[model samples]
Target: MDGGGDPQVAGPVIAALMERAAGETRVAMSPETAKKLIGLGATVRVESGAGVTASIPDSEYEAAGAVVGDLASTVAGADWIFGVAAPDVALLSGAKPGAKVAAVFDPFRDRARTDAYAAAGYEALAMELMPRITRAQSMDVLSSQSNLAGYKAVLAAANTYGRAFPMMMTAAGTVQAARCFVMGVGVAGLQAIATARRLGAQVSATDVRSATKEQIKSLGAKPIFVEKVAGIEGEGSGGYATEMSDEYKAAQAELVSSHIAKQDIVITTALIPGRPAPRLISDAQIATMKPGSVIYDLAVAAGGNVEGSEPDVIVEKHGVKIIGFSNTPAHLAADASALFARNLFNFVSAFWDKEKGEIVLDEEIGTAIRLTQDGKVVHERLLG
Candidate 1:
């Protein structure tokens, strides 16, 4: 496991630093991952206080065999730098030349940062682009985070609503259960449905993909779909939903308009990678909802699926409240950090070469996630 007594060679040095992105509370590494990386013969370093926001203290990382130090010391000579978001290239000055940085680079939206990483001669591994394949599921940051985001969205919406989620049989009178309508049955949407049902809401959901109808039903929720409409089979590559046909959109809008007016809560989770979120609920549609209804837009950071939805702000229109978060997963910092750290660890360990004491990615995953290498932006999607 130690690669056989090489006097001059040291195993790879892996490092993690505190996230600097606004509202980002998740740390890229946890003590659990630190211990695992060390077991694989890598020297793990975590910047001091990196895990504070995630409820992990430096002493815990030290207990897991990680060296905790200041930013400069932690990054010095590191071979792999992990983060929740790609750190600014300036913060990586002390790392080895061409060191690998695995994180969400948001390459399509922020070309400047990708270029900076390329110019600095670092390998940028955009985890968000992890290919949607069977073997890569455990390493998928999006699915893991979105699963949590879906749960959080429902919880937040339920909190904001004036009525209780579950019906009550009290002494005075019976309280009817709240109605929850989920738009876009992706990972987040599915979780939102499950959560709402658990909270005792009468749940119904809709998605562009007709396949999700069964999934919604499996979760004990009603599936509202536009039948006999073109573009209803919205499955796209990587298991994401593609844009719907104009006719399908009009039909779905008509269906939703009638359904939403009787609902108490709506959760919208539709997002196309590298594209603005598809508009699902217009202002006019929102205006038709009951006065006290609540809508949670999980895609608010991606320009929103609901009209007038602003990240981190609750805007009221026509007596309805619209709310969203710029970073929904961050609101559940502890669990989000643990899962995210495991994702990075899983990715590296899967490709680890025990004899060489390093990770060696195969073509399939490497091609999908490697955004920069050898002083140029190399990902095919970014090349054009």
Candidate 2:
């Protein structure tokens, strides 16, 4: 337990972690996340006053079932460790070899650090790398977080746009509903479409996956489908969009530009995990959009799906507003945390062994967990 920061204030992952510890397990938690853990059933250990940042008093953990202790001794005998972010190397040095460590390691971005974890003999489970399979839905942290991002993107776009989202009848005049275009029909994109539609906006969406067209239509939104290219199905394992050929991209881009110019608000959620987001809207396309239109790029962290997107900043070019929000999910921290925490709990439940005081990786469930195992990085697509 690093006790780096408070978990209650950080996200619901802490609450879920606490709840999971309730079932016949003697789990230990850092003071930051321990107060909630104690209430669930496990005995917690805190270092003096670890939950002060989150306004959780040290005595609260004790009342819930925790003991205050030194940080070094807390890690010395712990069989398992859990966290939202990866632990620092200094913290890792304190843990015994072969400890089952689980966290959002960001293995794709932090390859070197993950390799170091492997070399040190720690079984590091990267939550971000969980496969997008039916069985793994409960453990899909990325989807859980992105669902919030999708909802938020619509709100942000509505706020930025000068017009109202819904059509309104007033004494002054009749206001038409705003037209919103969503790129990519993934989880985030679909949610954006639904949110926009709920706000009474006339929503339309596009995706390389032909299968998503019906889903979009079912949500009472129009689905923009360009002509399918030969030899291109636009599908990938784990429910991700595959990279398109240059010719396919050009064709799709041309078709999208005409549709984009008519949209009052555009929310782009196109992203390929561990790769740069495909560039869907070019500078010229942005120029063609209505002067007061707003474009919210949800993929801004991965180089953006729209042109002129700058992470955490709103840029105006030729009277069109481009919003590039890096951590859109953080805006809804409480809900995001809860969903993420549940994801972590579901993932760890498969391995938790209360009586033996150890973790046994189930081959089926652990298939996704063992991205890096046996001194090697082993994701099916990530591995060469």
Candidate 3:
């Protein structure tokens, strides 16, 4: 997720513009969102062909009360710039001085790009960094997008595997159900467990938090990492896992390596914010997996947790297959775009004054999302 929203507005707001992000298949504003924004008293303009990759036709936007135009024409007088990722900084710099830009712009991993948006005079709202508070749940983009990613990761792994997920009965004998192991228990991991179980696979999961054990068990799957991380339980904040001690990591590696050998499908979803993904599977362990086993590394884009998992590349090592595809959610673009677009709508609606047709962003939620304003960095973590 990207952007910093300049939530303060007193006068009439211009159109809530959705420009086509080059090479991005996910559109920030879907037809569903256009209708919602229209009801909020904001004229919505979606760039022509913006949602085509998501298989949404232009007629859909028109039907939702949004005008379709070329990027420049749509962006003119843009008060709110909503996007899936960061838009071209130069393109947004041409907007009005107080214009606001909101998107899933990763402010922490790539601070320079975010800073460029600030220098160009747009407030950025990194939707992923929205605090995990009760009120902001509807606007939580990371969970929405990641939930899709986890579901897709399993489907991808299952499709790649030559065998079936569920047990089969035959005149010969009863075939055993595929064994699936999921690493990490965030929104993505939980979805992975549910998806695999729905496919009738024997699912087992691991997480650094003890809290995940019940969730894992409730899904009728076994919980891993319960014994190994005892002393380091609750080592994170905001429901995210923090860095473990070197010794604890070593123990985890030993435990996870042994577990990897037996799994028919392995999905690694471990990611520490602003850091390389924690390495859970090593090359030596990969070598030990059965020749036909498939490992799907969701963390591959963040420097994979599984060794030899290349970004967007598939490789087989000693008979085992390693898959590392970037943007798994984008692979399921239609729903990903819909969910993401809704998140953007909810984020804007949270601050929009329906009566005044203006944005009021001074709430505490603003403090977590607004990265820069008035040509200055506003988020405390970004400043440090």
Candidate 4:
């Protein structure tokens, strides 16, 4: 909120606060989005130094017509609070009653936070719950962030591996291309395949959803699938892959065991919403991989898809290096922040009512993402 308390100011106050989570480098609002929000007749405030980790300075926000101030001044009387992760409930104490907070609440994993928000009379919008529909494509933060995380996963694995991704032919001898395998061809997996292929690796990918086979081939990668298996069509609601049957899991494990043994680099991106990541590689499977091989688990933060993968640690097994980051997109913070801010801006502007000078979310998106309203946990998924 503007410090002057200017009565001339119109529309709701939108504020972007600093992220409190450890290793969170991305900011929810960027200068680009701040400018767009201001154009929509809203007052935009950003906490000074909030974007420092993402390499965005306070001067940039000021130049974009956003008022920059400390945390207390930024949130004071604000109507809407924006954040990458949901800000601590304590931080929202200064906001107006029933203020709208739009961010990644991770409601299933952290119900206590949503409960606090409900008790505080704040409207909690969990961006991760944004429905997967054609109209909401531009507002999909998961896809935006996961795409970058997938590209980073492959690059990190390539860096850790002793061998080069591309083959070399010199006066000495011709070197073969490194073999890369991507598990779970979601947005992240597809990006992993594309990135690995760009790095000159012989890329192959697999997914429970057979529909992704063509997507893999389009990226010039081979598709390794457990064909003719029941439950192989595992695409779930919101385009996420669901848990497969025991029979399908066995077949997948068998196929992956043989394929992974030959892979020089493996990147796993499988994840089920509100559930632990499905295990893809076992300790025995890791041992089968060649010495000096590298594996990057993109789902380590969600309990991991590869055995022995630890967040932000390089675990070596049988001379194979397994690595992953709890917050993969934060490694490329600048771009990640830009895309994320745009996604939030897209969601808000799509529902902005010009005459009313406020955002009025329609039932489709509102019901899908709203976790709390009217001082209660209103989301059906979270209600007991």
RMSD of 3: 3.8
- What lDDT does model 4 reach? 0.92
Local accuracy of candidate 3 as per-residue lDDT tens digits, 1-384: 111233432333334344444445788888988888878777677878878888998899999988787767677667777788877676664466667777887777888987887787788878888888788889898999999999999999999999999999999999899999999989999999999999999999988887788899999999977364463455368778888777778888888888888999999999988789988888899888888999999999888998888978888988998997777888888999999888888877888876666778865888888888888888888877
Every candidate's lDDT:
0.93, 0.70, 0.82, 0.92
Candidate 4 per-residue lDDT, tens place, 269-329, comes to: 9999889899999999999999999999999999999988999999999989999999999
Q: Spell out the clash pairs found in candidate 1.
A: none
Pick by TM-score: 1 or 3, better one: 1
* Model 1's TM-score against the true structure: 0.97
TM-score of each: 0.97, 0.82, 0.93, 0.98
Q: Candidate 4: where is the Cα deviation over 4 Å?
A: 1-5
Model 1: per-residue lDDT, tens digit, 250-341? 99999999999999999999999989889999999999999999999999999998999999999999999999999999999999999999
Look at candidate 2 and tell me the lDDT of residue 378. 65
How many backbone collisions does model 2 have? 2
